[model samples]
Target: MNIEVSTLAHSMLADLHNNNNNYGKAIPGHIPRVPPNIRNINRAAYDPKVLSIGPYHHGKPGLQAMEDHKKRYLREFLTYMPGELEKLEKLNSLIYSVRTLEEKLLSLYNQPLNIERDDFIKMIVLDGCFILRLLIKIRVRLESEADAIFEVVPLLRRDLLLLENQLPFFILEKLYELIPKPNSIQPFPTLKEMAFAYLTMKLSTDPIALNNLEAYHLLHFYDLILLPKPRDHLIFESNQNAPSTVPQASKQEEPGIKITAKKADNFLEVPFVEGKLQISCLEIKDVAIPIFRNLIAFEQCCPTAGNHLTDTRFMDLMV
Candidate 1:
């Protein structure tokens, strides 16, 4: 560095330059100064790595060094790999497994999976894990693009299935959540079961719902009856059959047929063999005769409306 000052700089040289020990060399324009907030870009060009790595160590590292670094990173991340080849082998295997499973699933389903049944649960869980892994791989690639494998992760079907509990409710709920509300269908066996689950958990304020309950029309095995004895049949259906002979059910009969009770246990039941009622059939339905007889036999004595089964303790009562 030149110490002798130009005529232009001679005046600006300070007395401090007279340190006295060295030559009377007034510092040239080289005196160190505090860097301004913004730095000079031109100065970075002289950096050794600027040609390749852009002045950063990693930037200057040649292709070989980059490959070596990648190998080391893979080895360390693979954890079980002994060297670069082993790491590459592990990566290949992992990538292949994900791709193979994804391909098979998409192929079999002909579309994305809506994992509702127990059969689909396992596959959905595996898919979720695979997506998470893909997200991690994307991060490692540093190529921050969205088209990579993770496109499946946030998809509604897998996400919902993943949220399900051991019961696979997560699987069903997710499906419902994703489906447009107006067109959503119950993916589970029965809405009653779903309602029961919600009721059990105290999830919703609405209470028990029943079939043909006037207020709510739920699908159920509707009670059917066949006219039994001629006398009983004449009493109920016969009179009603003839437009005239059928005395309009007196207002009195209306209350019984049209239940106005608050609780279900109070619904009118026509007495049969035992106290068991057949939804008000005058005669034991020929078809349902055995059912009525069986009920009578099972209940021991006459099974009346009073002998009805009512227990909140009942759970999973499929019938």
Candidate 2:
């Protein structure tokens, strides 16, 4: 027993030293998938029904319909470029660039991929081009000649925002840059601007410049735009030994206080007067619930994203 104890302690000490040496190198990106336990609760919330953009759900049976649309978008994008030879050369360059990054891109996900290198690169180009074309079409209000999916454009837009359904932002950005722009006096909008516009179609607030933002994916992009500047007073170092709870609004209202809902610039902006409290209007449609659920789940799983999650908790308190 004494010898066994001595050996275990030395082994643990070796592991501690090894970990210390490895500690300073930062992991490249957060896990792309929802936690398995969370997914078990509502599997549909984190999934895409119509399209699969990244490796996570690529080639799934149900998402096969959109694959043809992806090819069409790629062809349209190529045709819109200057010359056929220029288009071919540009595509070859993109394929070569993405092929070199295959190993790095694979590491972004939490699980192993069984895909071949060439197939994965091809999928990346197709999905990336598809997103680029969709954004431009929505931006320019270009009428689709034959595509049936544009009839249900609203539903298709939501499907793109699913947590598991994302291409790396850099890939999309690169593809957008390579494509030739239609005639314009003003510069073409950044990929971030186009995506934010598409996703938040109901909101009219002017987007902050894309140059100032950094995001891992579409969901992270949404979180950054919705997040307000941090107010120092919002942080509370609690001393409670047990969980803190709030009084029910109805129960507290009996003592001269009143609760009312009002529209705000964004969610989580609740203000109070002497006797009345104003809560921001948070539209909770059945469809939007899954969207919020997955966004919250992403923040919960990625500790680096916890600050945005903290903002969400602030909104919950207002509710």
Candidate 3:
């Protein structure tokens, strides 16, 4: 009896070791669901109010209204394709391409999705086409006054910036490559150019250098926009023994530090020269709060991305 018990114990230990080894071999997904602790604090910042781009919040209650619009955009988007084939044929071809990318696409999200393979492919097609159509509309300025989307453009932009609401940037790039533009007098813009124009229209203070940046998704693209461009020379190096805590803005006044707004290329440039805090002029609109909140949340969740916004230097200056 004693021998049998010892053998069973050894077998259980071996099974546990094998399970751990298998788990360790698995690679983690890049795009993660914001932790419940973080999401619960300010659900509005992480959650989409109008539209849902990715599988995370795809079919939520309040966001359902935009699903019909996505379908309409997908149909409209097909019209811009170069093929002489019917819309159904074009759609099937697009779906086939996307279906081939299923494994890669599924690997991006941190959690395993319960969606069917066909439904997942359709979601990617619909969402990717919707984004492409919106970018085109913004590029051409060809929207009718009766367009409902234009009326709620602010809300739509906000929804696009949410961390939970993003399709992998490659998906958009692939779809863009598949659809060729018609011959025109002016050269056709690349997907990056269109995205840059859309981002700069209202989101960014100035155009960011996107020459070699690999954006994971739309939110990641926005985070990239907020990053300060590298300068040839250093502004100033910090003392090695400086206090870790970022002082409040009010506390700076006590030390005779004068804060003034200066016109600069981007909002992220806040320089301190000779005790004067020169901050770039920033317009604090309703959209600003949610944008910053989501950005901060992103930095907190994705540590490897680096803390450009939430870093102590930036926080001290902003506060």
Candidate 4:
């Protein structure tokens, strides 16, 4: 009995030691799921409709239709390399380089994925390449007029901008660097330029120049576009002493208050000067609902992401 007890104690000690060693250094997860309190309110807004860009919603039944498109884009992207041999070599190199980022990549998500290591890496590569290719095609107008994907470009745009459907910008940047630029006498636009162009394709006003912006993901990139410019900082500061609450639209019907829509580069700008309130003109459509919800959800989920959506009194105007 004494020997058996001693052996049992020794086994427990060994197990504890193994568990301690297994606990690798903890890294912060940049990608977080919307909390139940917020997600329960409007689940559809936070969910991807057509395509899933990252692991969180990668294999959903509804999003599966786009999986074939992703593969097709990957194949098209590979063809950017001149010869078959060069394509094979570049792909192999990409895989090897991505493998080295396994731990770092895993750390970016809020939870441990149930996917196997190989499967996770494959998903990353496929999704990253698909995004880069899509952006490239959109920038160069290389997509066929009858392309099914292009037919639903608006839906694709919504899905790509969802808070949950995001691949890290670093992964996309890496894939863009690996893929050879198309052979053209004119210089190809940088990846940042391509992304900006794609995002602002339908905007009437020109977007602010993204000179030194660094985005964590596509949603973050979009959020950055709505941020007030440096000059607007002074304007915001001056309004710090303004009323704590904005008058409701119905209440603003009182005389001497005039509200007007002004043409501006960004829709988030709302400036009140000399009894007049000026808001940037925004054409709201059915698609704008989910996009706004997702942007607000992102702001709520990530505290570090400033309240660009909510703080500007833009939501009041939209409502």
In model 2, which residue pairs have backbone atoms overlapping below 3 Å? none
Write one digit per residue (lDDT tens) for candidate 4, span 44-145.
888888888778887889888889988888888778788999989988877877898888887777554678898888898888888888888888877556
Judging by TM-score against the true structure, name the best candidate: 4
> Highest lDDT among the candidates is held by which one?
4
Indicate the residue-level lDDT of 3 in model 2: 98
On residues 1-319, what C-alpha lDDT tens digit does candidate 1 reach at each position?
A: 3556564366456443443322222221111111222114232212222111101122234322333333333333455456778756755554444344443333322122233333343334333232222323432333355532234322311211110111122222332222212112333223333333322222322323431122110000111111121354425564355432222334335545431223222123333333222343234343333233322221222122122222212212311
User: What would you estimate as the lDDT of candidate 4?
Assistant: 0.76
Better of 3 and 4 by TM-score: 4
lDDT-sorted candidate list, best first: 4, 3, 2, 1
**Cα deviation of 73 in candidate 3 (Å)?**
1.4
List candidate 4 stretches off by more than 4 Å. 1-29, 143-145, 202-209, 232-243, 249-257, 281-283, 311-319
Shift in Å, residue 203, candidate 4: 9.1
TM-score of each: 0.17, 0.80, 0.79, 0.81
lDDT string for model 2 (136-162, tens) is 787765654656767767667666767
Candidates' lDDT values, in order?
Answer: 0.28, 0.72, 0.74, 0.76
Query: Compared with the true structure, what per-residue lDDT tens digits does model 3 show for residues 40-142?
Result: 8777777778888879887789889999999987767666665657666778878988999899888777544678888899999999988888887777655
Runs in model 3 lying further than 4 Å from the true structure: 1-29, 81-86, 143-146, 202-208, 235-258, 281-283, 312-319
lDDT of 1: 0.28
Query: What is the TM-score of candidate 1?
Result: 0.17
